[model samples]
Target: MKALSSYLTPVRACGAWLLMTLTGGGAACAQAPQEATQDRMVAKVNGAPILVSDLKQVTDAQTQGIRYQFADDPTKLANEMAAVKLNALDTLIDCQLLADEFYKIGGVMKPEFLEQDLTQIIQMGFRGDREAFMADLAQNGLALEKFRELRERILIMNVMRARIAGTVEVTEESLQEHYEKNLRRWSGPGKVKLHTVTISKKTADARSVADSLHTKLADGGDFEEIARKSSADSHATRGGEWNWLDPTDLTGTVSEVVLATKQGEISEVIEQLDAFIIVRVDDRQEGDPKPFESVKNEVTKSLMDEVSKGRIAERMIHLRAAADIQRMGAD
Candidate 1:
C-alpha cells in the first residue's frame, strides 16, 4: 500500500470515523428534521420575536443584488441552507441588539433623514427617474414607505459608528515604515509632464480652432498665451496650467498615449468627454518609489482604516454585553 501524500491526506475525513468522534455515533445518528417549518421562531432580541419570515425577508433583501446557484448535490444544498439560516439568525440578533443599544444612547431616527437617503438611493437606481425607481422597489418587495423606515435604521447604525468609533490618527513614523515596506507596489509604471490645451464640443468650429492654435504654436507663438485665449478648460484663465498629474489621473485612451511618450514630444488630437485635448510632454519621470513625505497622507489614511477596525470591534463587544437580549430558539 502506498503512503498518502501530505497535501492529499484529509485534515479530517467526513465519514463514520469523523461522525463517531463528533457525535459519538455513525451516519444513522446524524438526521435532519423531516419537514422545514415555515413559521419557525429563530431568535429573540430583548423580548422581540425574530421569526423565520423575518430572517427570510432580511436574507432575501441582502441577496437580492447577488447571484446564487443551488448546489447540484441534495445533501450539499441542505447543509448550505442550514448554514445560511444559522448565519442569518446570528446577524439579526447582533443587529437588533446593537440597534437597541444605539437607541438607548440618544440615537433617534429622523423622517427627514430617511427621505433624503431613500430619495438618493432611488435616484441612483433609476438615474433620477423617481416613478421608475419606485416601480423597481415595488418589484423587489420594498414599498417606498417601508424602504424609508429601513433607511432610518441604517442611518441610526451610522450614528452609532460615529459616536462609538471616532476619528483615527496616524503618525508620520508609521507612514514612513509602510512606504519603505511597500515601495514597489505604490510606484507607478511611468510618469509624464504634459502641457495641455482643451476645447469643448459646444464651442463653434472646434477643429478649425485647434488648427489655428497649432499654426500659432508652429510659428513660435507662446503656448501659455494661446492657451489663455483659446482653451475652454476652467484653468484656461490661468494659462492652461494643470499641476503635474500621474497618467492614472487621466481617463481613457489619452492616458495610454500620454504615458507612452518621450520627453518634449507632442501628441495628436485626443478626444474625451465632448472635448478635444492637445498634449505635449515636457518631461518624463521613470518608475521609482516616491519619497515617504510625498505619500504621508495616503499612508495615514491606510493606518486609520486599520485603527477603525479595532475600535469598531471593541465597541461592538461592549454594545453586545450591555444589551438585554433573549433568544427564543436554541443555538
Candidate 2:
C-alpha cells in the first residue's frame, strides 16, 4: 500500500506519529462490533462525510497542551476540550471545502512527487524502516489506502492556499507604513561610553586631586593615561573607562554631569557622597530611529503575514458560502 506523502513534511510526519504514540491508538485499532456501530458523522461538505474519529484525531493533537495545563481541573478541562473540538471540527469542514474547490478549480500534483516526499517522511519518522512505519499505521488504525486518500485531500487544500493566500506580496508602502507605525520596536535607548577620574575621600587631598585631574583634561592630557595613574574608582584598572551606560542606569551628579557634557569632553570636579570625581564621555550615541533600509525585509514579511491571514479568511468564507456544508452533532 502506498503512503500519502503530500500532506506531511518530514517534520510534521514525525509530529503526527509522536502525538499518536503519546495518546496511544490501541482503542482505534481494536474496535469491537458495538464500537463500529457507534461511529457517527460530525460534519459533511458537499456530501463528503467527516466522521467523529476525524474530529477526534485533530482535537487530540490540539488538546495536548491544554490537557497538561488543566490536568488538575476536570471541569475546566471538559470546557476547554469542548471548545477545542468545536474549533477543530470547523477547521476540518473548511479544509474539506477548500479541497473540493481545489480539484474543481483544476489543481494538479503528480503522484511521483508525493511518493518521493513520503519516503523522506517515513525515513525521518521511522529511521527508514518500513516495518516500523507500517506497525505505527496499524497501531493508529489507519489503512495505507485510506491514509493516502486523506493526504491527497490535505494536499489539495494546500494547493488552494498557495493559489489564494501564498500569492500575496507586501508592498513597499505597506512596509514603510508598518515601520513608521512601530517606531519604538526598532529604536534603542541612548547610550554613553564614559571614562572617569576619581579621588577617594580617604585620600588626604581628594578635592585637590580631582581639581588637578580636571585641569589636566582641560590642558589636553590623555584621559585614559591620567585616569590609570591617579583615578581611585572600581574601573581605574581599565583606565577608569565604563562601558556604554544607559540614561536610566546613572543618577545624581554623575547623571547630571554626563547628560550635560558633550561627547569627547571632560566634566569639572563634581562631589559625590564620599568622593570627588570627574567624568568624560568617550563616545555617545543618540537613539536614532531605525532607518528604513535596516528593517525593510522584516517589515515586508510582517506586512505580508497580515495580508496572507486576511486572504485565507476571505477565501475560506467564499468557499464555504459557495459549497454545500452541513454541521451535525456537537460542532
Candidate 3:
C-alpha cells in the first residue's frame, strides 16, 4: 500500500510557497549582492522580504503540472502559467499573513509533535532517505528550516481546529430518521458461513489438488485440517478461515459460486488469479434489517461527522476574518 503522505503530498504546501517566491521575482533579488540590493524590494509581507529565490522555487514547483497540461499549446501555456504565477503569489502572501496571525494567537506545535510529524513525513514521503529528501527540497529551492516553519504553521492550524471545534453529538432521533431513509441499501439476499481452500498453480496442479480435497471432504475428513495442509493462501496457516463475509463483499465469481451453493455443499473448482478455490457453505442466514437498538452507535457516529464538518467550516471563516491578511499583488 502507498503511504498516506505519498498520496496526500503534504510537502505540496511548501511547494505553494516556492511557487510564489519564484514568480514574484524573489530569486533574482536574492542573487543580487546585499550591499547593492539594500534598497531594492521584490515584495514584502508586513515588512518581511519575500526573497527572489523563494519566489522562483515556489513558481517552478507549482507550474510543473500546469506546464504539462499546456505542453501542446505554447500560447495557452504562457497564459495559464501567468495566471498560476499571480494566484500562487497571492496565496503565499495570504499563507504568511495567516501564519503570523496563528503565532499571535499562541498557535504552535509542541516540540515532540513536530519531531514525530517530521519523522513520519520523512519515512512516508522519502522512504527513510532523509539526506536525499533534503537535497531534493534544496533543488526545488526550499530551505529545510523554512519548510519546518511551514510545517509548524500547519500544525498550529490543526490545533486551532481542535480548540474551536469541540466534541460533536448526534441525537437518537436524527439517527432513526437516517436509518429509516437508507435501510433498503443495507438489506441483502442472504449470508453465508463458508469454508474455503485455495491452491496456487505455482505450488501444485490446481485441478489435481482440488480433486484430492473434494474426495477428502466427501470421506468426512477434517475440512480445516485439509485446508491447512493444501491451501496456498496466506490464511492457510489459520486453516483458511475467512470470518463470515457478506456475499456483496466477495469478488464477482466467488460471490456467484458461494451464493449458488447450499449449506454443507462444496463448490466445483473455481479458477481465480493463479489458483483454484474450493468453497463450502457451512451455514446461511437470510438478510433482514437490524434492530435500531443494535446499530444506534453507528448511526450516532455518522451524524456527529456531519455536525463536525459544519462546525469546522464556520470556524475557518472566523479565523480568516480575524487574521491580518495583506496580499502582495492581489490588486
Candidate 4:
C-alpha cells in the first residue's frame, strides 16, 4: 500500500523473490495468478488501473530466483522480497506513464520487429524451442498475450530512452575532461611479456646450468626449446611463457630483476629457494596516457553514455511530475 516516489529510478528487470502486504494473504497471493484469474487492482496511472496480476508478473520476474540466498533468515528474506516487489511496482507505474507519453509523442514501432524480437528471445533463450518457452510461461502462470504486452511496453520504454539519448551530444571539452580524470583506465601500469628457463637446486651446479641457458637465449637460441629440454619449472612445457604480466605481481628479487631489464634483453641468473631462474623480457610497455587524438572516438562514446544516462533521468523526472500515479493500498 506504499505510494512510490516519482523520483525513483525504474526497477532493474533482472534477479528474483518478496514481502508486500496485499489481499488474499497466503493462498490467493501465494504465487503469481494465472492469466485467467480475475484482475485485482493495485494502482492506477491516469484512469488505467494497474492490476495485482501485473504486479505479480513483475514481482516474480524480479524475485523468485534469489529466494534461496536468504534461506536461513526468513524475516530478513521477506523484507528483502518486499523491497524488490515495491521497486517493481514503482517501475510499473513509471513505465505506464512513459508508455503513454511515448505513444502521444508519435512513437511508432513496426509489428514485424516485435515478432522478430520474440523469435530471437525464444531461439536464444530456449534453444529455438517454442514449446519450452511456452512451458516456462505456464510454470509462471503467465499467458502469452500478457507476456507480449509486457515485452511491448519494455520496447516502448526503450524507444523513449532512445529518444532522450538522441538529443544528447558529447562536447569536446567533456571528452577531454573524462579522459584526463580516468587516465589510469586508458593508460595501464607498466607490463612485460616474459619467458623463463630454470634449473632446480637439486640439479648439479644449478647456477652453471642457468648461466648456460642465459647464454643460449642471448645468442638467439630458441627460449621455448631450451626451456622444454632443461627447465625444471612448472611452466617449462609452455616454454616458460608468462604472457603479459603486471610488474606488481612479481615480488622481491624477481620484481627488481625484471623491472631493471630492457625489452628483448635477458636477465642475470636469479637465485631462488627452489630454482635458479633466468628471464627474458620479450616485450615491455610503459604506463603513459595515450594521446588524446588517438583515443578520441572511444572517449567521445564514453561521454555520450554519461550524457544519455543524465538525459533519461531528467526526462523521467519531468514525465513523473506531469502524471497522476496512485497506489491502491495507501491509507
Candidate 5:
C-alpha cells in the first residue's frame, strides 16, 4: 500500500524533526545521533513517522512461529523474517492511512464514550487514582493529551471499518453461488449411530452371558432394554447408545465389527481384552450434500462477510492512491 517511495533520512534529522513537530521543539539536534536501532524512522505516512520499534512489535510476534518452522535453515529464516517486517510495516502504513482518511472526513466520536473508557481504565488499573494515571503516562514518556489522541486514533479507525463494511450488500443469488462454489464444505461427513451391550471379563461366566445376549438380540429382542439390563460399559445408563460418530475413529476390532454390520442389524459377540461386546448398527449416515435452501442463511452471511472484506480492500487501495506514504531504504 505504499503510495510513494521514500529515502532514508539521517537519524538525527528524523529524530529532531519528530521532536520539533510533535513536541513543539526541544534541545539541539545539530549533531548526528548514535547508530539508530529501533528509533530509526522506517516509514512515513502523510508526514507521520513510523519508527522501527513500531514495526518490530508486529514482526517479532510473527517471527516466533516462523523461526521454529525454518530452524535448520538460517538463510530461509532470515528471509522470512525480513518479509514479515516489510509486510508488518506495510500494514502499519495502511492503518495510518485509514486513520488519516477518517479524520479528513471529519469523523467524530462521542466525547462521553472516550471519557467513560478512560475512567474505566483508571478505576480498574490504577484504582481510580488520577495521580497514578498521570505518573504512569510520564513513566511511558507520554503526556495525558498525547495518549488520549492515540487512543482516539484507534477508536476512529474501528468506526471507519464499520462504516466501510456497512456499504456491502448481499443478495440471494450471491448466497447460492457461494454455497455451490464451496459445496464440499457444506456437505456433512459420513457417520454412524450405534448401540452396544458389554459383558465384563471379571463377571463369572462372561462368555455365556455375551452369547445369550447376542442370541436374544438376533431374535428380535429389544436392543435398548437388553443393553440397559446387561451392559457393563459406561454408556449402559443410556441404554448403550453411542453418539453418531465417524467409524474411522474407532480403533482395532471395534471398527471392523461396526463397519461389517448392516444397518438396523445386530453385530456378533466381539471378544476384547477387557470385555465381550455386541453392537447394533442403528444407522449409517453417508455424507449428505446440503441443498442451497437448507443453508441459505449461513451462506448469505458468509458471502456478505467475504464481499465486505473485498470492499474494504478496495477502499484501502483508494485511500493509498490518495495518500502520501514513504518507506526508507526499501527498493
Candidate 6:
C-alpha cells in the first residue's frame, strides 16, 4: 500500500460509497434464493465472481433501516427490500470493479497496512476488544483475512477518489452556476431582524412603566431611544438591537409575538416570568436568498463534490462498458 499511503489520506468513515453504483451488478433478492446454496454468484465483474453472501453483507444494514421504517407494513418493506438488495449488489459490484482496476494498474496493498487498519478498527470500532471484534466478524460469516481484503478494497476506492478530487478544480463559472441552479438549497430559512425594549418585572411598578413606554412608542417615540433609556435586556447598550435571527431562536410565545408583529411596528408589552418585553420588528425575510459572495466558499466545496461525483460516475460507466458484467437471476 505504498501508493495508498502516497495518494490517500488516513481513511475514516467512507461517506461516498455509492459514487459509482449506476454501472450495474443488480439482482432482485426480494423473491427467492438464486440457488439453495448461499454462495451463488450474484454478479461477475471482469471474470471475478461476487457471491450472494457478499451481497447480503452489504444489504444487511440498509435492510435493517427499511425494516424498521416499514415494520407496520410488511408489503412495503418487501417491495423496498427488493430494490435495496439490487442497489446493494450494484454497490458491491462497483467496489469490486475499483478493486480490480487497482490491481490491474500494478497497485499492491501491503500486509502491514492491513494490520495497522485492523488494529485501528479494533481500537476505534470495538473499544480495543479484539475478542468482540473477532466475534462480530465470525457472526457475520466474514473471516479475518477476508475482512481485511474488504477494507483494502475500500482504501483503494478512497485513494481513487482522492486522486480524482485532487485533479479536479472548481472554476468560478461553475461555482456560480451551481449555486444559481440550486438556489432553493442555498437559500436560508425565514429570519427576522429585531430590536427589543425590556422592563424588569422585579420593579414594583414594572407593568406601569412598560405601559407608559408602550404608550410613548405608540405616540411616534423612537423605539431605540426609549429602549436605550429604559430597557433591561442584554442588547440595551446597542439600543436593544439584535442581529438577524431565525424566528424559532426567540422560543415559545416570544417567537409568536415577533412573527405576528409587522415590520417597523412596535409590539405590545409581552409579559414574562421575570421581565416585561416589547419588540420592534425592524425587518422580516422569508426564504431569504443569501448572496453568492456570502456563501462562495460553501458553494465551491459543493461544486467540487459534484464534479468529483460526475467524474467517478463516468469512470464507472467506462469500466462497466469494458468489462464482462453478468447479472445473475432477476435484476
Candidate number with greatest TM-score:
6
Off by over 4 Å in 5: 1-38, 57-86, 109-112, 118-151, 189-287, 329-331
Backbone collisions counted per model:
0, 0, 15, 7, 0, 1
Task: Write model 4 residue lDDT over 1-331, tens digit each, in one string.
Answer: 1111111223322111111122322221112235535676777787666787777766775465445555544434566688876677777776787777765654554457667667766766677888888887776666776766676666566656766667656678888999998886577558899988889989998778888888888898998999899988887999888878897787556776787788888887777656778888888887898888998988887777778878878988888788787788621
Measured by lDDT, the strongest candidate is: 6
Candidate 6: tens digits of C-alpha lDDT, residues 215-297: 99989988788878999988998988999999877745577778778888888877765788888889878886789999999
**Candidate rank order under TM-score:** 6, 4, 2, 1, 5, 3
Off by over 4 Å in 3: 1-105, 110-113, 178-302
Q: How much lDDT does each candidate structure score?
A: 0.58, 0.66, 0.60, 0.68, 0.66, 0.69
Candidate 1 off by > 4 Å: 1-40, 68-87, 177-297, 327-331
Q: Using alpha carbons, what is the TM-score of model 5?
A: 0.45
The digit string of per-residue lDDT tens for model 3 on 1-331 reads: 1222221122212321111111211111112224324533446655555545445545666566555655654434666689867765554554454455455554444456666677767776778888867776675555666556545544444444444456775566788897787674345656778888887878656678777888888778888998898888777877777777788787646787787788888777776656778888888887887787787776676667666657866755665576544434332
Between candidates 3 and 5, name the one with more favorable TM-score. 5
lDDT of 2 by residue, 148-187 (tens): 5555545555556655775666667878888999785566
**How big is the positional error of residue 52 in model 5, measured in Å on the Cα after superposition?**
2.2
- Collision pairs in model 5: none
| Cα shift from native, residue 83, model 4 (Å) | 6.1
lDDT (C-alpha) at residue 120 in model 5: 61
Could you tell which candidate, 3 or 6, scores higher by lDDT?
A: 6
In model 4, state the lDDT of residue 207: 74
Q: Residue 50 error for model 4, in Å? A: 1.4
Query: Model 5 over residues 1-331: C-alpha lDDT tens digits?
Result: 1100011100111111111011322222111123323377878888877766545534544566576666654434666778876677676676677667665565444457667657765776677887887776664444555455444444455556666767657677777779989886687647999999999989999999999989988999988899889999988999999999998687556776787788998887877767888989999877777888888888887787787777778898898898788889433
